[model samples]
Target: MDREIAYGAIGARLETKLNETGLSRNEQAESLGISRSALATYISLERIPSASTVARAVDRFDIDPRWLLTGDERDRITRDQWVAVLSAFVELKAIMDRLFKDRIGWHQASHDDRMKVYRAGETLYEIGGISALNACANALYEGNPGAQLGAGDMLNHLFNGIGPWRA
Candidate 1:
């Protein structure tokens, strides 16, 4: 099978595990050191995760890389992974809304809705602001300075336990 297709299947399978374990795609990706977009694609069965990605799943979620890749959710995401995802979401939110006001517009529905779904807590500021702010966090986290998620194993923990919650 094609790599993308494989990744997509794994991604879809990963999502199944996430929902069973009550995790969000954004949260799961961060814990595994992958981008949120990558996770989203995986969940929709549109993309596949790399080897390192699988390793991250093993290290963070404790779901056994072999099984996770092969479409098994017999295991659950570790408590440690859960904490990591939550921290990432909190850290990202703080930066976008409070620290970086100049970068966002602060709109509704599209932006905030996604934010609430992915990041969790306190209704989103607005769509424009949410996206801009989240993009800032994304670029900053995996790129430049102020990468709050930190560099290490179990990076996906940065986004765990969050969902489209009312603020």
Candidate 2:
């Protein structure tokens, strides 16, 4: 297949994932670490995501890269992979719930303090069989209308240089 045609297929899959997450374009952009206009270009099939972006999506969403790129619906991930994904999510939820138990925003914390927490999150993401899943969940919760104050603020803090864990 031509590269453009393949990109179009991938773009369609990206659209489907975006709809599945029920997030607005801005939220999706943030989750993907891309700008809104970049996402727009992707959705319009004007350009494809970079390799890093594609890898990020796979890690962040538990997406099967093969299916994402080729539109092959067959499950590429093994049962073990699925289990690991679920387990990591459960662990991450526990971790976040514990970290935010006080329900006070870490937004006001110093940079070093926040960086410590952000580093923790990054470590867990690397070693816990979950890649930026916590951030994805945060973005998801933040985007949802019913999400309250304690949800999804970590990513914002971390990205904005404030970090995520409580000081």
Candidate 3:
């Protein structure tokens, strides 16, 4: 599908999900950590939600990122996969928290440092952030190395092969 058309379809699905929530638009926007106008734009297919926005929505609403972006939620991920996803999210969030904290203290970080954080966050989003991380984890469990390789590679580089975290 073309990008525009796919986004429109995703937007339509978003609208349906929102309606199913039984919340007003403003309330939904607040819950999603976005402005009403931004949500409206997404519903109207004027723009796609960024990875950051998707992550926030996943967190705030307990959404499934795959379902939110692709409208498929029946597939189940294994418990181990869910653990991996959560682990990835926590690791990525910690890195981001540290980056921002340093930036705040020093007024800025090197461009490379900032880009590392940006790319890592984007990888998290691509792997469904906290919401859809399970899907990627499940794929990995099945020996699929091609599940969002950018995310997989970045995670490997940052977390050293997704083993148990130390310290």
Query: What TM-score goes with each of the models?
Result: 0.36, 0.43, 0.45
| lDDT (Cα) of model 1 | 0.44
Which residue pairs does candidate 3 place in steric collision? none
| RMSD, every candidate, angstroms | 15.6, 12.8, 10.8
**What lDDT does the true structure give each of the candidates?**
0.44, 0.55, 0.53
Error of 1 at 57 (Å): 1.0
Model 3 is weakest, by summed lDDT over 10 consecutive residues, at: 134-143
Residue 118 lDDT in model 3?
A: 43
Error of 1 at 110 (Å): 56
lDDT of 3 by residue, 63-145 (tens): 66566655555564444543444555555545544644454321254566545544554454444433333333322222333
Candidates ranked, most accurate by lDDT first: 2, 3, 1
Model 2, runs deviating above 4 Å: 1-5, 79-167
Candidate 1 ranges with C-alpha deviation above 4 Å: 1-7, 72-167
lDDT of 1 by residue, 62-113 (tens): 5544345443334544545434444545654554444234433233224543
